[model samples]
Target chain A: MVPIAYYLVLSAVLFSIGVAAFLIKRNIITVFMSIELMLNAVNLAFIAFSRQWSQTTGHLQVNGQIFVFFVMVVAAAEAAVGLAIIIAVFRARNTLNVDQIDLMKL
Target chain B: MHLALFIIFAGLCVAGALNLLLQRHPINSALSLIVVMSSLAVLYLLLGAEFLAAAQVIVYSGAIMVLFTFVIMLLNAGKEERTHGSRLAYIAGFPGAAALLGLLTYIFLSHSATFGQARLGEYLATTDDISRVLFRDLLLPFEVTSVLILIAILGAVALARKEH
Candidate 1:
């Protein structure tokens, strides 16, 4: 039996890595991928908590998993719209570098 | 057995994430993200969310990643050029991430007893179980997501369409 804490620790580590990647990576697509990574990490935590509740209550609790399902749905929608915007930005600016696409930067 | 499986997949997942960060090319990064997603799907299975494990694989690895790869190829994205980005970002980002991880790890480890242990196969959330909740209890949100998807589709089409 794995301690639920272990799963939570793993999720935290993955999320921190995602945050680092999000901040450090310059490519817009890589940044987008990091966002996905963060979402995945949160989903893992949600499931871990769900399992913990089920273990303590002596029944299966589906709420956490259900939240994860909705998160996935939203993530899918976000990816579609985000990639399209990325494409449009690429077409207009002709580069994917975040630093160079600072038209709105003061 | 379950602990070992969890360690292996978790290690793979972290490695894939690090690879995604280190790789210079977007395509390479995309491939590593696929690796991460696949390992995550395995982790979901270990957590006894069988349906989510399948969905993670089919939706994330199969559908979303393919879309990413297609766009990467379409744009002809190249290896990222190194730039000495703002010094503040470099100084703040890594340490900030480490601090966040340490804080979370400390909290979880210190309070491990509250969370309890998760033995594999003890409590499985079958597809039938999940769908019942989704359709009956969460039916409104479920249907709303369909509308959300439609809006996203329209938005994507509008954004990506060529401007004559």
Candidate 2:
């Protein structure tokens, strides 16, 4: 049996890694991927907590998994819209570098 | 057995994430993201969310990653060029992330007694069980997601259309 804390710790580490990648990576696509990584980490935590509740209550709890389902749905939607926006950005700016795409930067 | 599996996949997941950061090209990062997603699917299975494990594979690695790869290829994205990023970012970002991880780990470990252990296969959330909740209790949100997907589709099409 793995301690629930182990799963939570893994989630936290992955999330931190995602945050670092989001900050350090200059490519817009890579940054988008980091966002996905963070979402995945949160999903892991949600399932861990769901499992914890189920273990303590002596029954299967579907709520956490259900929320994960919704999260996945929203992620899919986000990816579609985000990639399209990325395409538009690429078409307009002709580059994927975040630093160079600072038209709005003061 | 479960602990060993968990450790292996978790390690793979972290390695894949690090590879995503280390890789210079968007395509390489995309491939590593696939690896991370696949490993995460395995972790979900270990956590006894069988349906989510499958969904994680099919939706994330399959559908979403393919979309990313297609866009990468379509754009002919080149390898990222290194720049002397802002000093404040380098100084604050790495340590900030480490601090966040340490804080989360400390909190989880401190409360481990309450969280307890997660024994594998003790309680499985079958697809049937999940669908019941999704359709009955969470039906409104479920349907709303469908609408959200539709709106996303329209937005993508509208945004990506040629200007000419």
CA lDDT scores, all candidates in order: 0.93, 0.94
**Across residues A9-104, which tens digit of lDDT does each residue of candidate 1 receive?**
999998998998888888999889999999999999999999999988999998999999999999999999999999999999999999999999
Per-residue lDDT over B1-164 for candidate 1, one digit per residue giving the tens place of the 0 to 100 score: 99999999999999999998899899999999999999999988988999999999999999899999999999999989877666877798788889989999999999999999888788999999999999999899999999999999999999999999
In model 2, which runs have C-alpha deviations exceeding 4 angstroms?
none
* DockQ value of candidate 1: 0.85
| Model 1 docking tier (incorrect/acceptable/medium/high) | high
Clashing pairs in 1: none
- Per-residue lDDT of candidate 2, residues A11-85 (tens digit): 999999899899888999999999999999999999999999998898999889988999999999999999999
Reference-based lDDT, residue A38, model 2: 98
RMSD of each: 0.9, 1.0
How far residue A75's Cα lies from its native spot in candidate 1, in Å, is 0.4
Error of 2 at B161 (Å): 1.0
